[model samples]
Target: MTMQLAIEVDRADDPRLQAYTSIREKDLTSGHGARFIIEGKVTLETALRRGRFKLGSLFLAKSRLEPLADLLAQVPQDVPIYVAPQDVMDAVAGFPMHRGVLACGIKGDIPSPAEFLSQGIRAAAPSTLLMLSDLSNHDNVGACFRNAAAFGADAVLMDAQCCDPLYRKAIRVSSGASLWLPYAHGGTGMDMVNAAKAEGYEVWAMTPRAGARMLGTLRIPEKLAILLGAEGPGLPDALISAARPVRIPMSSGFDSVNVATAGAITLAHVFGQRT
Candidate 1:
């Protein structure tokens, strides 16, 4: 029999539940070491299956326990599962407990571009990848991860300024795609372009600048890395110059779409053709 012993905490002040306490009031950069809070059923499921995170504990609303028992059984017995009543959940988290699913886990290292390229995405068949720059919003980053998974992108690379895809809200928004995707973070946008090039990937930078090739007409190579920037300003001139510029078609007077939407469209175009 699988021993799924769930501990019940009656008080909000319990030190064992420190990871779930007053999250809105705390800053992620201050005391958080490698551990991050995971939210929702889908996200926790992916995180558990991926085994990338070292889980600390699971804080679930008492009512949600039965629904999540199958998933809970997959969890190692060494990890504690905490079940709390609705009132206790709300009191501990300082918010209403709706989904009633939550987890605390440790984040592992994200490899750098050179190290990642050493694994040979270039050697693979008709590959696809997304290189993101300065994507400050966690939700957007998460959505891009979802798109990458949907379109079968081999990997995702985020510039130094892009937000962490593992942010609690990002994990929820991604429906756990962020947990499953292989991602690397480091360097500037140009650094990513060059790394992709070094791996023999045909680097294409997506932008709306003058003289850029239309998205529908461009020829995607065997190993392609598409670069996307945050909305509004788009890719920097230096980064844009580092790779071949490509642009998506749009109606007159409408020049932009949300970064995630644009990436998905672009990814769909390339992936759809390959398959």
Candidate 2:
């Protein structure tokens, strides 16, 4: 596809730069979808190698473009490439940048929850799954998805408050696992819990509370939904009380592992013992 350069900016606060800056939750909800921003040379090169998202445009500091010559040659001649002064590029992205190249590409859409669940059942054994409950940080959410994929969790279910898996930062942090791992989000986390139970999944809530069963001793179920909550609060009291609670064995004096780390350890255990 022919790519066209739309605008170039010399300053971060330049009006043309507004679309790329402030890509937080509020901005996304207002309906401005990013055509994927490729920040830094490494990430840009990775995207080029994969060739998944549709390339839109390329931006680079003039000094750095020489090193990327072979990669640039792969681009269609019709694609617009912009050269900017190093100072202007750094200011525009809000950091002293290492990778001078950035590109814009189309962001892919996530499938519906039902579609994701059905796909998971078809792809793998009816096994363990990770369900996130209102985990808001993009980094944490991305890490959880990465761990789930690594440890053979069948899929991920995000509650409504969780960050969008397709968000650029989350996708990057996931190393593109977010694109391949099956996931669906809708309604409250509790609703998903109930639905999993209806599907014969033994839901296990991961918590550090006193009465919870030690994860090591419990008999892992054949079909499981590993429920996790946000870092500070952990799982909701009602949710914990409803599902069988499981706690990871931890050393004394350590408060708790980060939710993503805890999830990785828990999922590894569950996958390890599967019959």
- For candidate 1, what is the total of clashing residue pairs? 0
Best by TM-score: 1
CA lDDT of 27 in candidate 2? 32
Best by lDDT: 1
TM-scores of the candidates in the order shown:
0.93, 0.74
Provide the RMSD of all predictions against the true structure, rounded to 1 decimal: 1.9, 4.4
Whole-model alpha-carbon lDDT for candidate 2: 0.73
Backbone clashes in model 1, listed as residue pairs: none
Worst 10 residues of 2 by lDDT: 1-10
Clashes of each: 0, 1
**Candidate 1 residue lDDT tens string, 139-251:** 89989999998998998998888887877887778878877778888777777788889988898888876689999897779888989998788888898888898988889
What ranges in model 1 sit over 4 Å off? Answer: 1-3, 27-32, 121-123
